[model samples]
Target: MATSGPVLLVSQAQQRKSRTYTPSPWGDFFLHHVPCTPSQLLSMKERAKVKEQQVRQIIHETIASSDLLHVFEKFRDESGAIVSGDDASCLLMLHDAAHARTHGEEILDGIVAWSKSRLQSLVVQKNLLEPELAEEVRCALETPRFRRVKRVEARRYIPVYEKKSTRDETILEFAKLDYNISQAIYCDELKELTIMVELHFWMLGVIHDPYCSRIMIVKIFVFISLFDDLMDNYSTTEESNVFTAAMERWDEQMAQQLPAGLKALLVRIFNATNKIEEELKLQGNMHAELIKKMVINSAKFYHAEVKWRDEHFVPTSLEEHLQKSIPTSACMQMANLALVSLGNVTTREDVEWVFTFPKIIRGACIVGRIANDIVSHEREQASSDHVASTVQTCMKQYNVTIKEANEKLRAVIEEAWMDIVQDSLEQERPRALLDIAINVARVADFMYKREDAYTLSFVIKDIIASMYIYSV
Candidate 1:
């Protein structure tokens, strides 16, 4: 569990008592989540498998079909086919460009560029569309489907599609059924799905990739979450530094000097990390060195932040802060580790590409780093031992209002999304690998979009219920 997001801080024992963490809003409710009955579980799993086969068939058909990716190559207002023709032609071009762009095909980039430009103008055209249609056009222009997480987009599109004049009853019916079954599978995985669990699901489910890695990822997350709290709210800097050394040494004996809780945590982490390595080896991945290095490095980053807190250091600039914080997100490590569970679909080259922090990995990390900071900064700043967060540092460096600093961070997230899109078009990386990296960012954005839904579990209690408690 490599800690990510803003590091929590606590003062020394001499100055003041160590801080304590806020309890989970759900409290002991987590202890009582009942698994679905066996019959219900079988039904949902069977339905999901059927849908999986249908999706595979569709993908085969798509790859085997004739290429229409270039059908709108010359479509433009001046070409006398898009704008000069009837409104149907304009609509057709818009749909075609949108379709290709969403699929990550760069073959129609020129057409997409022109189509988007014209669509932006047409969004304001009063006579061409009804008021409702105009609003849809604007919304589509502002937040295209490619920019959304698939699960989020599905839940959102239900009402919109229900209102459409030509909506297919069969498609809508299947969508509702599919949503419920997927939610069941998600909920069945754990008591409640936190943001990292959501991230683990999406990283694997986006392309229907192997899920053998999820067990490792989620276990690591729980361990790291506990360790992060202990380091940030309870332990002295001396204890954290020793625990970090113990991590690097990979020895239980090295942690003997620490308190009982920390020693137990270190042992659990060592066991969890080793279990991951062993399980992955059985899957034909022998990257123990890489996996061990990631765990060690994660501890190092956590220790560094603790040092910053103990010294009362405020980063002078936002870049300086990100230089340390982004790595703390562990996006690169998570992406690399996930490749192992993919079995053979991914290559060593893909793992190396991530290790180098290519544009896609860096972009994904930034999205997670900045989005987490945005929601947690205010609560973090309230602490006397506040370690400088992205929001706080931005306000200090740019001398802007809190709202303005937030706006700036949101803009940065948008740019990171662009980088994800741009890298996908390159197609140099494996598509499976690309989805793993891209969806890391998407999960972060979804979790932190409106509030700290991850931390303030109450905010997403309904969503959790929708996935776990109710049937569609």
Candidate 2:
């Protein structure tokens, strides 16, 4: 449907009415609530590391003598044996066992199968349980803690743990402190990101990690976000074309060709890329050149979307759209950032493996692209001169209604998730990169669950507060 000339005869800036985003609900609230100073946080981290080593050594000694099969049986007995008497503990065990069975580690598969069977029985008899316990049972059966990542489960479980008669004060206090500290770190990251007009975005994925290295990654996330905003929403086609060429060359002199706004944008882009390169190098990452290459490649992908918009191009089909869309989803770049952000533990092999854009990462990128497009299609089109969204391309290729196209795309999202789960269970890659890929996918599902939560920040105001603003 596009041509050499833009289909929209109107000036893009004239037609591109900006969306008014609200100030974050917890503005400046976190800056006031940081319980510990920077030095204290560092001390706490060091102490936590020491304690973790002690715990790991103890676990190693225990595992050497203990049979995991026998340990799993204890779960079977605890949950299955007294299901009528202890609703909460029994429900939790059955839930754990059921999900564990579905993922089904070979050694524990038998016990997990038994737990699913037992859990089904409890579900059938939920009528006799306390109302609250029945709800808990339903949630466990449906969403299950195993399906949730650590942070999500932690938020859900902390309250549940506190309700127990035997809840330990030390553990409870520790959980409170840990969550708040993580929240504080998130606030600090957000403050830096705000300078770039971003985040509460990246921290959705990096919520658990508080190291300074992650701030650099967050910077990249912000820069890319602003870069997209500039090209897709604000800049003229000619300006975007010029700026993209400058980026491709990565030459400072090219900035002279841009208008004032784009000139500053190009300078910031170079400065940010250089800083990331510098930081990665300082950590002894030998793959700095590759990282820079990825940054440029990602920018090129972003510009492809802009060019599509500029030409008013609808992709010939979904396949053509995805060729660029998947990479532009930011999954690959974030996965690369995740590798280096973890510090010196990243081996050359790890960097090489991630750079390959392995199967799991592709699946994750699919989910990130499609899931986001499904939720964000309207907002993006309205706020910017958006090219054909995933939905549009699907509709055009399949000749389907918007609802039907969305349904097909939603199926694609599930397929992508299946790929992620299957690949993760294989354990063929570095655990950290795989986990980060999964988290990137998780963030997509969450941030776009019912709305474009990132742009429509109010949708997740309570969530942001819970994760970063409020105490446990």
Candidate 3:
């Protein structure tokens, strides 16, 4: 196949200076410069260049060719291992092909399966390879680029590509510069958002990964944080009701008669949702329309809580409290957004399953709602106007002490988690989908385990700095 990109060249001076020697614990290793003919050195350099060129050709062919089977046939030798001799490059191609949206007619499926098996075998025997090559193999095996954390992958890949003589210097330089630029953008977005409403963007590193899916999830959480703040601190019962109705209508006319802050928030939500829908469409997800309904339902649930607070009506029963609070938790909406982030792996059936409010989804939301109540009820009670949390409702209905109510709520949280575990085992749920729901509960636990970490900026500053500010 004809390659489109310009060929890269490595200078002899640069190649000569690239060798390194490390002394062994045994002693003075004059072995570092074991006598070699100048011709031998030149031959080694040429062989390295040939291997690099082959690897780059494989990458280019995989990317440029529409017929994956033809590309696979050309790249693989009789034994079926990719002919590149660069395992990392082959692994990258396998990942890209596996993730391609070809519906059920995946031409690269056999290649992916073969590549995975071959890679696993190489990883097991990695001790036989050079230190750098061994590490590369280990990293690829540990987390394929498709699944690797985005920021970590950038940090890891830049040096690998830099060492490849066949890689265009301009491309390597661009990757380095892009990493710095992306980090700056993430920091700026997080800093402004943290000030407005406390949240830890630990997942920001995901921006470097596939389709910007991780950052999209972060964006959804940012909006969730802002919406929570507006509901908890700013809007009155009447104002919140009006805003909720407008959200349900989801039209420009609904923005009329709203306060400036609520109006601005509505616009942001609309724009964000529109952007998310566009991304979903590009990924070929047919259920993109469901995302808007999920968000609207979340808003309506928020309004229900506001109504209860406004009427000074605590639920008379635990069931009533759960029924009201679970949807309002917004975990389901977040879970659905998480599904959307999976791109081609998520089917319309997956979206429909989520909409059904299965055991796992319900369990996760219940855990989140009750966990928040457990940690934040005291602070929330200090506020003159506050919706009754699960803790308060349990305390009032059972005529129990605060400690007892908390204990009961904790048990409920435990039961909900069991429900998740049971559903995961029985239904053969998609691991990715299950993971998102599990993460929703995990985030809830992290935010509310000791206190409302999401509401308290200082509590998670160290975490933010370590994940985003400090390099790995």
What are the models' TM-scores? 0.75, 0.77, 0.58
Over 218-329, each residue of candidate 2 has an lDDT whose tens digit, in order, gives 7767666666677676677767777888888988898897768779978987887898788778877676666667667767878888768767788978878888788778
Question: By TM-score, who's the top model here?
Answer: 2
Pairs of colliding residues, candidate 2: none
The sequence of per-residue lDDT tens digits that candidate 1 reaches over residues 432-469 is 78887877776666667677666666666675555445
lDDT of 2: 0.68
Clashes of each: 0, 0, 0
Predictions in order: lDDT: 0.66, 0.68, 0.63
Tens-digit lDDT track of model 3 for 320-398 = 9888888877778777776776665778788779877899899878877998888879877776557788888899889
Give me candidate 1's TM-score against the actual structure: 0.75
Which scores better on TM-score, 2 or 3? 2
Worst 10 residues of 3 by lDDT: 12-21
Residue ranges of candidate 1 with Cα displaced over 4 Å: 1-11, 15-22, 25-76, 79-143, 158-165, 169-178, 191-213
Residue 130, model 2, lDDT: 62
